[model samples]
Target: MANYLLKRGNLWWVQRKFPVDVKDQLGTFFRKSLSTEDADAARLAVPQRMREFDALIGQVRMARDEGDLFANADEQPALDQMLVRYQGQVLSGLSNAAQRRHLRVLEAFGAFVGLNLTAQQLASRAKPVVEQWLLPSFGHTDAGRRALNVLIAFYDWVVECGYAQPPNAFSGYRIRPIKSVVVSRKAWTDNECELVLTSLLAEAERPANVLARDNAWRLAWVVLLGLSSGDTLHFVCEAQRQTHFKALSADWHKTRACWPEIDPYWVPGLSPGGPDGRRSWQLQKALGRRLTSLPGSLTYTGLRHAAANQVRPDFDAWLARLQAIDLSPAQA
Candidate 1:
């Protein structure tokens, strides 16, 4: 009973008439035999057959539009040939890793625009396609910016080499800016610092592996050092030797000045390189995890702020008082 359903002899068929504009590319009438005598079966077959007809029509329209856009498409250099020439000329100086990264961005672009287009056709259509299709596909992220940058670079090369016209498609295209949220790093209060140090000291006393106990002790020192001196974890982890109160101290690596003497604190029998020869970063990460397991949300970096908070009106006095504070388990 559908409008497109027809009967020719004993067999049912589905047919549609193409629009006047596309009739030349497609035919005047689209027809496919349903090969069913039953009216109910023919109706079911008509919908699927109509979908196929519509798909074919869409393909014809796309082909017609492409043909119109590039009349002498066959005369232009193919995309693959252009890429090979561009690689040899422009990307030859880059390292293999850098070249591969560029290729990945190019490959994603090629997959979207397709390889059938000539370098000239692509260059002509690049701006609209990149702004509308390519950028939106990658979204507004670091990856999207990288992709945009690579494409712009590629087109610049294309124009310089005389393969394409001037005014790169992606040259001025700007991806939407990423909005960032500001997270406040709050300074730990006196009671909070005491609680964290007490927990770490308690952890150090428990029976555990040498590495675990060493890390707990090191974290306690890191916290104490940060609180007293307002120095970073990196400075503490990288310290080669302990400076006692009476010793003439060498210049601190970060500040290039002699650091004020603090009470010597060292993990018993643990090397400066850390237990089991672990790197500074590895030790820092382990200490960070141990710190995270404690009750408060304040990180190791927050202790520096706590030091400044305690300094208030007098820095030297506060540092002298904090330096003599004992970190022994009973005193913690």
Candidate 2:
């Protein structure tokens, strides 16, 4: 057997063999606890540890054969090559925007440790590169955690591709939670929603700049939709125009105000500019000013949550009717 799996106390111990030639430089066998007592759990964990051990053995064998593994490989591979392959094959399922974000994470890591460096060069010094450069660059935030996650995937891919070895240096790292940045989300109150609607409705009626009217009209729609439907801001903004939940064709392009026949008022893509595209920030600021009780950073998401709460009385009434129906049948 290349490695041994033994149970010591309640934990499963994975003992990997060290190369006899480099036994003095390394050791006889490297042992680590798999930290599980269950045999099935230990069996599931063995493949990963085995892959890691096999990679370590390859490194030792390579070093013994050629002075260094890096020296033995053909023209040093570019980091971008692996990234391209990874994106095309592994990340093909992701949306364009999601794929771009993952690429940015990879790019950030590349920047952390010069883009020109190969996977082998990176894997060799993973610990220092992560601790000194990667972690520090990201700080202790959600973005940092995302960066680490991407790096772990990248390293794992490299290992699978035979460009790097096992025991992926960046694997098993957890992001340290930073409590200061956490914010508790709260829904908007009825009074607050009313204030927003009143302010925007007045602005929509304003006979001044056509642009201002357009902006107000868009915000009013968003606010009303969010307050009633509980749709997400992204959905509120990007969802195609629909008449009674049925999608509108591209040829049906006309502002909801102009297309009363199409019944576009209740649809998402209502505005001539198409759902407050460029002016969304301005609209957000305007709504923020009206609802002074909430932070200016508040968006339609909070508004929608509050709007959902507005339906509670209706929901309760419906529930009561359902119970009444059951009781009537029983009483008769």
Candidate 3:
């Protein structure tokens, strides 16, 4: 149904069905590249010219001898492959991330922080809306800003993979710069930690809200074990379980912990919970399931701040101990 195609090398070719009147214009485009053959030309000159122009002159000559493009086209299947990979692989990959993973993280964050979004419809629109409709309204103070940084990293990955154009759709935006605050702070005070743990335990005991209740109680886990370095909720959930499964979210948040040789996440419950291992391993059990959202509280990043301040021996010594680390006060 198309009138013409600029086959691989940018030369335009008219379809066999093109009208006689339209062929004059098409002929102007096709014949412009033609040149008189020179006796002095090397053997490679003809093929090189053909490759540069992407002309189907041989097929045209054959058509004169017989019929059109030999009644078949060669470049069509290759173009179909390009279109298929672009949609099925690249676009599907990015859209799935925005839908299942990015949207869920945004929801969990908004719920915990008592915030709302511009509208889901706005997020579904073009690039410009992210800042106007999405980012500014998220209320990303220091910790929230860092979380936004993680999303920015995802957009960067999309560009690097060539799914996006150069320069990235989400680049150049800034968040709260959590670094300056991290060093002077510690995760939580003894009282605050106790409050969180107790609140979580009580939450877990409730009959309904099983998911929220369980995660709230176990939220201090990696911090308790000195692993507060990261939390891609779903990946961390999967890593703790140590099994193979199709990832629900985009591949961006995956940790090396899933690959034990690289990731050093604390896999709790080599035995069970409690020092003696007789009590319930509720934290371990909750962590094993697929989480709809991560358990976070706007009040909780104070724990991270507190932990950073409490780092003894010095920042360098503390940095050396952790396998993975992020923003600190000096960098802020």
TM-score of each: 0.42, 0.34, 0.22
lDDT of prediction 1: 0.63
Top-down TM-score ranking: 1, 2, 3
**Candidate 2: where is the Cα deviation over 4 Å?**
1-76, 181-332
Candidate 1 shows a clash count of 0
- What's the true lDDT of residue 210 in model 3? 40
Encode model 1's per-residue lDDT on 156-228: one tens digit a residue. 9877766677777568787765855322256777777767766766665562554555456556655665675
Looking at candidate 3, the ten consecutive residues that score lowest on lDDT are: 323-332
Please give me the total number of clashing residue pairs in predicted model 2: 0
Cα error, residue 250 of model 3, in Å, equals 43
Q: Give per-residue CA lDDT, model 3, range 1-332, as digits (tens).
A: 12232233543332232222223223524422223343223232345544433444334323343533123433222222222222333333343334344445434434433332222222233254345435555555664465565446544544454444556545556656434444223345555544444444444445245445324433434333232433333334335433433342222123223222333233322334566453234544543332212233323345445555662223232223222322111222
Task: Write the number of the candidate with greater TM-score, choosing between 1 and 3.
Answer: 1
For 1-332, candidate 2 gives per-residue lDDT tens digits of 32478989989888865544345556778787889988888878888887887677667555554533235345456786566556545664565456778878877777767767787788776788768876788888788888888889878988876777687878867777485721225566656565566566566565256556555655665665555467765565555554333543222233333422333334322434335454244445655565564443455556766766773223232222222221111122
Instruction: Give the per-residue Cα lDDT of candidate 1 at 209.
Output: 57
Top-scoring candidate (lDDT): 1
Compared with the true structure, the alpha-carbon lDDT of candidate 2 equals 0.60
lDDT of each: 0.63, 0.60, 0.38
**Candidate 1 clashing pairs, residues 3+ apart or interchain:** none
